[model samples]
Structures are given as structure tokens and as C-alpha cells.
Target: MARRNEALLRWFRQTGWTQRELARAVTRLGQARGYNVAPDSSRVRRWLEGERPRQPVPELLAALFSERLGRPVGPEDLGLGSGAPPGGELGWDQRGLVTALQDFTRSDLMIKRRDVLGTTAALATGAVLENRLRGWLDPVRADAAPAASAGRIGTAEIAEIEAATRTFWTWDAKVGGGLYREAVVGQLKAMTDLLEHAYPEQIGRRLFRSTADLARLAGWMSHDVGLQGTAQRYFTFALHCAKRAGDQRLGVEVLSRMARQMVHVGKPREALSLVALARRGAGARIAEAEQAMLGTCEAWAWAALGDAGRVDRAVGTAQERFSRAVAGDAPSWLGYFDQAGLSGMAGLSYRTLAEGDPGLAGRAEPHIDAALRLRNRDAYARSNLFDLISLLGVRIVQGEHAEAERMVRRVLPVTGRISSTRTVDRIRPLARRARADAARSTDAARLAESLDGLLAV
Candidate 1:
């Protein structure tokens, strides 16, 4: 089954464009369509070789191809569709929830691209939103699980898998998601295949749960790689798997990710609604720590929307919950949500509201600083970099160019490696603000110039 139906690659071949030509054409189309796409021909080769496109580009690709060929080209053409090759598509609906979460932990590398080389694939943000809303409204249809019993994957396997995932997560946070996403994705795909083929009923159930975790990670890695639509699809699958496994808490967590993605793309209102839905589900089975983490996330959404009161209230709740959760070991799912994590989130929220209250600058600083203190580079690093960038923006806004320069200089190395478009988006505003508050000889001027140099190529 895996051998013949390379439908996606075939479709690309039919487009009458070489990798270089396709890239050039797409770049031209982006220019015409008013998107700031710094397209490179090498990325086209990655797309042809089964890598998914990142947010903004996937849709742009579809649109560009549609315009050139006079028809619609979907993510599938780029091999990002549901029917991707063996072990490729972590069909969350087929697996159970625990597996989905397990997949989430391990799937980071599968979706990442070479961001340091500027090879991150871009998914059309609108396409992802469209897909998520469509799936939420109409729901994706899941195939019935294969009739197989569970296998002998035991505590050792579970521990090994978890450790591996944590390592990648840490690496992804520190070095860049692009560095490890593919490896994670491929591993999950293989794991899914084995479980689907030979595991027993009892084992199958547990395996499915584990697979769900990997799938979630895969989705996240996809997002990191800039393949928002693919990530959305994977996340939706992970949610379905979680539901099948009867874990409402995990399902809600997936929803939170969806909402976070929305926030990344400037849809705070939609993000807030998604977070609200997550909160409602949190009432069902989440641990105290998870609950607090959700609240902190909610605060971020509210802050993004300029709702100071709600952000404050939500942050307070999050802090209280997090404090209570500290006495015991948190669930594996909630292990990633720690004091530093929540503090970083709080920092972002406060920074967002800093425009109205100068005091927030002080409040945001400590949290951001604490987050940076953590040696564990997981998602926390990528996320906190944004807070630092946000803080730099605030400094620029306050005519503190020297401070802004120092912050940006600190942030650049971190941002350079991560395969996150959102980080780039965050940096853009700071650069613009710096340029606006120009000082010819200041460090802020140098930082802005550096940004311009990077963008020029």
C-alpha cells in the first residue's frame, strides 16, 4: 500500500515546474499577492521530498498554483494530506488518547524544517483556520481501528519513549525545532505502524494512548516547522484519539494548542473562545497543575486582546493553581507546565497590557528572567523568546534604545535556530519600533540594521 500511491509527489511532477522554477514562481506570486515571502528554491525540493509547507506559505502555495494552473492545489499535493506514506500520518482518530499524548511528546522532529537555513515550510494560516473550523463544525471522519491485539510494549518502552521525547523537546526549544522535527515524526509513524499491525486488544488500547501522545507532538512539531495546516490536521487527529481513549483532559489540551495557534496568527478572540472550551473540559479530568496552566494560557489570550482586567484575573487564578500543584508529581501531560512556564506566560500577558500600565514592565521582567534561567530548553525557550522580544518592544516604545538593543541581541541567537514563524513575527515589530525610534550610533540602531541584513537575504 505504501509503494504505489505517491499521489502527492506525482501531482507535483505534473505541475510543469522544476523545484527552482516552482520556487521562483511562488516567490513572484507572493510578491504580487502582497505577502512578504522570502522564497528560496531549495525549499521547493524539500516540499517535493514529502516535507510539509509552513503557515502562510501552504495557502500561498495553493493560491499560487491555483492561479498559475487555474485550479486549486491542496496540502496533499505537497504530501501533507492525511494519506501520507507509512507511519507518516498519525491518525489520532484511529489510535486512543494516551497514545496521542505520547505521540505529541515524541513527534517534534517529524514536523520541523531547517529554520536556521530559512527553509521552514509555510502553511497558509487562513487555510489552517479554515480546516480547523471546518473540522470542528463538520468533524473529520475517522477510520475504524485495525483488528489487532496489543503487543508487549511495556514500562521500559514507555519510559524510553518519554525520555526521548523530552530530550527532543529540550533540544527543539534550545537549538531549534527544525533540528529534530523530522526524526521525531518518522519515529512516531513507525511506532504507529507496529501498534496497528500486531498489538493485542489490551495492549492495543494502551498503545493507542501512547501513540496519541506522539501524534500531538508531531502536530506541534509541524506547527514549529511552519506547517500550520498539517499541524492542525494532526492536532485534530490527536484530539479524536484522545476522545476515543476517553481522556477529556487531553482533548481539551489539544484544543488549547489550536487556540494558541490562533493567537500566534493574531486571532486572539478566537483563541480566547478555544481556551474557554479548554477550561470547560478541564473541569472533567485535569490535575490541578494542568488547570492552572490552562488559566495562565487564558490570561495570555485575554491580554492579547487588550483585556487587562480579565488577564489579571486569569493570571491570579493560574498562580494559585500552580502553587497548589507544586507539592506532588504532575501528570506526564502536565509536566511541561511548571512555575517557569506559567511565569513566562504571565510575563507575556503583562507585557501585552504594559501599554496601559507602565508598571507591567517591572512585573513582566522577573518572570521572563526566571524563564530564561531554566536550563531545560523545551517549548519554554521558544515561547519565552517571544516574551523577551515583546519586552524589547516595550523598551523601544519607551525610548530605551540601548535596553532594546541588548534585549534584541540576546534574542537573535535564540530566534535564529527555532523553526517558529511567530518568533519572527514578534521580532518584526521590535525592529520596526527600533527603526521608528532611530538613533544613528546606538546599539538599537545596530540591532535594527542586523535585522534588516538578515531579512535582505
Candidate 2:
């Protein structure tokens, strides 16, 4: 006999669904949404016996229950296990989101439960995406707590937080994310505590916006080190804070970041949807530089979709918008979308397309070269290494083995200094390709051996 799941049993009885019927309904729901879930009656029986289904099943169950109940339901409501921190649920109220963020930040800072917190599995599901979008579009409300009557918070404190966030951003750009993650988490923990206390309405809104900025930075840093699950949580928290601050622009930026993450995780179709949501959220008031950034992200999604025509049009639009952008006209967060950044995105789009159509190899090379030349070596070391790797791949495809070998040699030492798995992922494929063609050229063989030696450690 197994332990009883009272919560699940209650919901099951209320819905009047037999175990087999419920399993069939879940199967139909998943298949209708492009998932291959095929939970049988036995699986549903296990759930009633307190055996939590993996991942997506929990989310799928929640969505099913929510629809049947005519209200939002979550894994917690069904007593299902979740990878999210305490209070982490889709369709949470604003206070719930804040509480979840605080708990998550504390755990992250203490480095407890990292294994559960750092998983990327089940993150890109349709149900999760729809829930998050609905939450973002909902109206902002003031916290239930009254304003502080004694201790007061003001702009100076917010400025200091902003300045620190910028410093962390610079460190992330110069060094890899692993180096500064702890410090950012510490700052965020402190900020979360501050937000919990009372302050004037104006001060409270500014603090929320500032906190959102920090959260977004932390998410980006987590992404740099390839902690996609952790990054997604932070991005979600930032979206909540942005909404609480009544800053639609910041919310749009967070959505764009999430979209980029989706692209990196091989969900380009979902990524395109996120980009569209970000654009819609921005409405007609988006700044030129911000538009450029969104356009580049859109191009990346299109390239991933293998739509060469849409990729070309999107990249062109990005370049044009970026050209029209003037300094100080865009938001501070848009600082990273400079000429070098745009070139890198363009290079990435062309390189992805070139993988299928080698004729685009020539087009990719110049943009990649511009990114390498224009990027500041000290600040963008990791980015530059990725660019070099992309360039090497393009050269190999073009049969310029000598240049490819030279590029590998240049990037190998840089790779040692970086802690990004994504960088290694790109380089490993290039090395394998070179090794496969080693019989054709001595230089290729030498490069392959070198890469193997370097990567073995």
C-alpha cells in the first residue's frame, strides 16, 4: 500500500474523474499541445498514492485542474513536487511572487538545494509560458503593508543599488559569471529584505524598479555560466518586480531576456513567440536601441527556424534601428547593444543560416570579423572567444583549413580562462569536425589533437 495524496484525491473527487479517465484526459491534453505525454491509468493511480509524476506532468496536471476548476491551480495545490523554491507557483499573486523570490534568493545565496534549483528540465513548456505571460500582463498593485512611518528610504539608496548593479554587470562582462554570482546573490538578498519593509509610495516603486534591474542582471550572469533553470527563476522574479514598479519597459526587457534564453535552449519556436510578446508589451513607445535588440533576438529565432528570408529582414531592421539610436536616448540597460554587440548578433544569424547554406559563409565572415575587431578585449573576452569559434566554424565549412586551424589555436588559450559551458559546447563541435577531416590535412590533425588535450581537463 502507498501513502495517500489527500490533496490530489480531493481534486480528483471534485472533478469526478476516475483514474483511467483522468489519465486519458491528460494524454489528450498533452497530445493536443504537441507533447508526447501518454500517462496511463496506472500512472494516475500512482499519483493518487502520493507518487509525484516528473516535470511537466505536474505542470500539465495543474493546467488541467485550473481549466476544470475555472481558476488557476498549481503543483502545490495538488501536493505535487516542484523544482521551484517554496511559494514558487505559476499564477501566483504579486505577494506570492515576492515571497518566492525572497526564499529563492536566500537559498541561492546559501548555496542550499542547488541541485533542485539549477535544473533546466521542464522549463520551456507551453503551460508554463502561458501562465507567466498572463501574470505579466495583469495589473500592478501596491503591497498590503502601509508606508513606513519611521525609517525612510529614498533615491540615494536606489542610486547606490543601481551603481552596484552596474559594477556587477561590468564584472560579468569582463570575467565569467561563476566569478561574481555569489556577490550578486548577496546584494539581491539584502535588496529583497529592504523591499519587505515599508516606505513612501514613490520610494517604494523606485526601489522595486531598482531591485528588478538587479534581478535581471543576476539572471544574465546565471545565463552566462549556463545555469538556465536558475536564470529562469530570476528572470521571472524580475518580471514581477518590474510589473510592481509599473515599468512596462523593464518588463519587456525581462521578457526579451527570457526569449533569448529559450533560443539558447533550442526552443526557437517558443523564443519567437516570446519576442512577439515583448514587442507587444513595448507598444509604440519602444526606444530605437531597444528595438534593435529585440529585432536581433527575433532574427536569431528566425535563423533557428531556418527561415532565411525572415532572418535577413530582421537583421537588416536591427541594423537600421541601431544606426538611428543616439546615446542617452535609450534606457541604461540597453548599454550592451552597441555596434560590436549588433555585429555579433548579425554574425550569429548568418553563421546559423550558413550551416545549411554554405553560400552565406562569406556574408557571416565580415560581420564576425567586425565583432572581433570592435569588441574591447578586456571587457568582452568570453564573447570574443565565442565569436572566434563561430568564425572558425565558418572557415571550416568554406574549406579554409589553414585559417580555421589558426583560429582554433588563438581561441584555445582563451577558453581556459573562461568558465562558460556554452563556449566549450561550441568549441567541442568544431574540434570534432576538424578531427573527422584530419586525414585531409596535417594542420587539421594537429588542431584536433590540441583540442582533445585542452578539453580533457
Q: Quote model 1's TM-score.
A: 0.67
Which lDDT tens digits does candidate 2 get at residues 1-457?
6567777787778677788888998999888888899999998988888676786687678667655643334565566634332223533354555555655665565433223323465364576666667667656654464224433567887888889898888877777787888789789888877776677778878888988998998888787766776787788778888878888889889988888888777888888888787777768778899999999899988887888999989999999999998888788777777899999988988887787787888888889999999999898787888788789879877877777767766877888787666676566766787788899988778777876765664
Write one digit per residue (lDDT tens) for candidate 1, span 30-117: 7787877766778776665546666556655655553444322444343454433332333334534224323332333223223232
Each candidate's number of clashing pairs is 50, 0
> What TM-score against the true fold does each predicted structure earn?
0.67, 0.78
- At residue 136, candidate 2 shows an lDDT of 70
Tell me the spans in candidate 2 whose CA falls farther than 4 Å from its real position: 1-92, 112-119, 146-152, 439-441
- Who wins the lDDT comparison? 2
Candidate 1 residues lying further than 4 Å off, grouped into runs, are 1-144, 148-159, 355-362, 373-384, 413-420, 439-447, 453-457
